[model samples]
Target: MMRVVPLQSSGVRGHDNANVDFVRESFDSEAFGIEIGRIRAAYATSAAGYRLLFKSVLQRARAEHFQQVLRRTRLENLEEVWALEATGFEMMDVVVTFARSVAPAAALPVWPDLRVEEATDETFEVIAHERAAAFFVGIMEDRPAGYVTCVLHDHTGEGEIELVGTLPEFRGRRVATRIIERALPWFAERCRVVTVRTQATNIAAANLYERVGFTLRCTEATFRANVATALRAQP
Candidate 1:
């Protein structure tokens, strides 16, 4: 199953009003199914307008049998958040982005006998599935302790820390921090800024980023719904 969610329009404008639309597409080759949905966020001041928007979106989702529909609103968009929640698409996640300058780092305190290295082709196959532009691995006693993937945006001169993971056994040893700290200078050399996004629900990850100099930039409320559940709830 593959799902694609793309923004159709940043926001649509009318005489004195604006709205945002996102289109989500999902395909399951095995099931031979394709689902498409449109999620709209309207800038409206009245409750009736919000209700009408939700009703239309829900009706369209049901008609198309979309397995999942998502509507994301800025944290400050309380009205949209309330309207989306009222429609049964509960807030599932809070996505937060953090940014920091690319500066040379003071040497990270070495974990005893631990070293970080560029991921080899063999390790990349197992760890990153070859999706990373660059991959680094932290090795402890010749075992993979943690890894981070860097994706560069040449046009923007920005690099994103795409994925970070530490082996369960190495969780409390600051392996994630080591991998990130190790990767930053590499990115700094190639890009002007480095950014990462993670779920706000991940307190540990958020704390780690903060301790590493990343500051909270913004957060969005993510909503999710299942078609089956929506159907079950309707008359």
Candidate 2:
């Protein structure tokens, strides 16, 4: 089983008040009959702190025969001293925020064969498969078409769009948009803001949010390193 260690503060925040965490953990190494460990820094961790953390992880990896050690960092936070070239890169994710006050009047789409409804336990199970603060499902001719799950933060008056998806056959029909439109009023009543995150590379998803009046807030990057190689080169 893959195991994750709790994030540890690195006490380094770059110019933007960004901080980083040192993450070290193990996974089902023995299941595969090989020890696999991972070490990474998160957020705005300082370069010095990352090196220190990496050295300690390297020592542990050697003694434990760890077959692999993975490290991840944000592109912005990455420093020259880490000395680990990125093998691959994934586009940063973009965060978008919407406000209830500016939300347009709920003009639900009228589909001749499709209808929007609150998700029942059975429908919710088929869609989200987990308990959600609130959920909405779209049904087309008695068949499940799409769904969206929402979680509300009462204190912050923020509502999160945890998941939204549509069956492949229902794509390009605005099934997702309608489901989200239907849920907005519900969210607006109780939450001041609604937020969602999507990969920056997902232009379709970004366009969808823009059509719904969500404003782009920020983006975050992801970086990776092979600690096993770094340690082997150590003299």
Candidate 3:
């Protein structure tokens, strides 16, 4: 399975008939602050598979302006790890996803210094469109302190806290926590499970999510390659 979620249809499924594949991640680019690509092995192969695929990756990156290419694989997949590194990819980080059912209380909290606002203006429109997601924003001191986006995959009834962040100065104020809390009732009503992911090295982040009732579900290693420099090196 492709570790990176299918953000868009990108790249040839099998280039040069190698046992590997790639897709450009349009959504992750916004999340990571860099243009990104995701690669995966269709089946186990030697380093040469990744080597041959790198050429296609470069072509796609060149055409689409990708800054980095990433591959997510299990930590135990030594063969894939070796192939990726041999192809110039470097270990980036370990990503861990946490999951839990966020049961809602009779009444969601009424924040004194915050408000839960819809992600879009569709809520106020004359006719509402079917929504697959919602953005819960946190208003602090009359400003946008932070926000958490929860996506409901109706097909599977799985909810994901797609993204969460708070201003640097708001770090210790429970901004992220309250932002997430504000989304729980919205999620609990529509999803069987709510999940969030973060760097395994970010103990503080992990602790925060756990406090919000999320528990570790899975972990994967992220590898990256800076193809822009390689592109500059090319003729």
Q: What is the alpha-carbon RMSD of candidate 3 to the true structure?
A: 6.3
lDDT of 2 at 56: 55
TM per prediction: 0.66, 0.56, 0.68
- Model 2 Cα lDDT, one tens digit per residue, 1-235: 1111232223333343444333333223544566655444433245554444455555555666665555543344446234334222223233333333435355655667678887656655544434356788899868989988877654356777777888999988888888888878777766667887776777777777777777776554433334466565554
Candidate 3 segments whose C-alpha is farther than 4 A from its true place: 1-6, 10-21, 28-35, 40-42, 45-67, 103-106, 121-132, 152-157, 227-235
Candidates ranked, most accurate by TM-score first? 3, 1, 2
Better of 1 and 3 by TM-score: 3
List pairs with backbone clashes in candidate 1. none
Model 2 per-residue lDDT at 10: 33
RMSD (Cα, Å) of model 2? 7.4
Among residues 3 or more apart in sequence or in different chains, the pairs in candidate 3 whose N, CA or C atoms overlap within 3 Å are none
Clashes of each: 0, 1, 0
TM-score of 2: 0.56
Off by over 4 Å in 2: 1-45, 50-113, 126-131, 153-157, 224-235
> Where's the lowest-lDDT run of ten residues in candidate 1?
1-10
Query: lDDT by residue for model 3 over 1-235, one digit each (tens)?
Result: 0122334544454444555566666566766788887774444455556555665676677687888888888777776677667666789899999999877679887877677666565542211122236776687888778877666654356888877888887788888898888888888887668988889998988999998888898898998888876555544
